[model samples]
Target: DQQVKQNSPSLSVQEGRISILNCDYTNSMFDYFLWYKKYPAEGPTFLISISSIKDKNEDGRFTVFLNKSAKHLSLHIVPSQPGDSAVYFCAASGLGGGSEKLVFGKGTKLTVNP
Candidate 1:
């Protein structure tokens, strides 16, 4: 059972355009949402994240929003650059109870063209 899902397999955006990536989850037990970015031949790097208690979190050009009632989350990258192009994965964990286990979505490949 895929608890987390990234419906879109890929997304393309022009450089300097806003890129929005969406994610959904079926598991209501998740209390933490995380976004990770992975480059070719490299491990997934930690990106922005949001807690179940927070509706939104922003860091620089990246922002993450969590809608607990809708069991949905999204990542927004403003003025997307080519360097921001990567496979973005959405992950969730029951961090509220100290559980380290994480459920991840299949990921969406983002291509930002100049």
Candidate 2:
């Protein structure tokens, strides 16, 4: 059905602490996984991504891990800051010649307390 699922609607963490978000997908054809962070009324910014061929990808404070066997993926933020409070969306797409639009989950709102 092309559905990516993020079970948690929200997460809260203290500043300088680790924040983790989880997501799941049912489609086996999906070959790319992406994470996007969004601020209020602003477009989502690309955070990190992993291809099905790889298990882990990291970018500074952000990290993404993919488990192809379980059709699951997760995003981790190290030393979360007050500015990190925003919505996180997990997305996936299949490899194809034509346009493969990304399918996003409901999104998780992360709050970082100072």
Model 1, 65-98: lDDT tens digits are: 9988899999999989999999999999986742
Candidate 1 residue runs with Cα over 4 Å from true position: 97-99
lDDT of 2 at 105: 96
The 10-residue segment of model 2 with minimum total lDDT is 92-101
Model 1, 38: alpha-carbon shift in Å? 0.3
TM-score, candidate number 1:
0.96
Backbone clashes, candidate 1: 0
Q: TM-score for each prediction? A: 0.96, 0.94
**Any runs in candidate 2 off by more than 4 Å, and if so which?**
96-99
Position 37, candidate 2: lDDT = 94
Write one digit per residue (lDDT tens) for candidate 2, span 22-73.
9999999999989999998999998988888899999999989999999999
lDDT of 2: 0.92
Give the least accurate 10-residue stretch of model 1, judged by summed lDDT: 94-103
**Top TM-score hit:** 1
lDDT of each: 0.93, 0.92
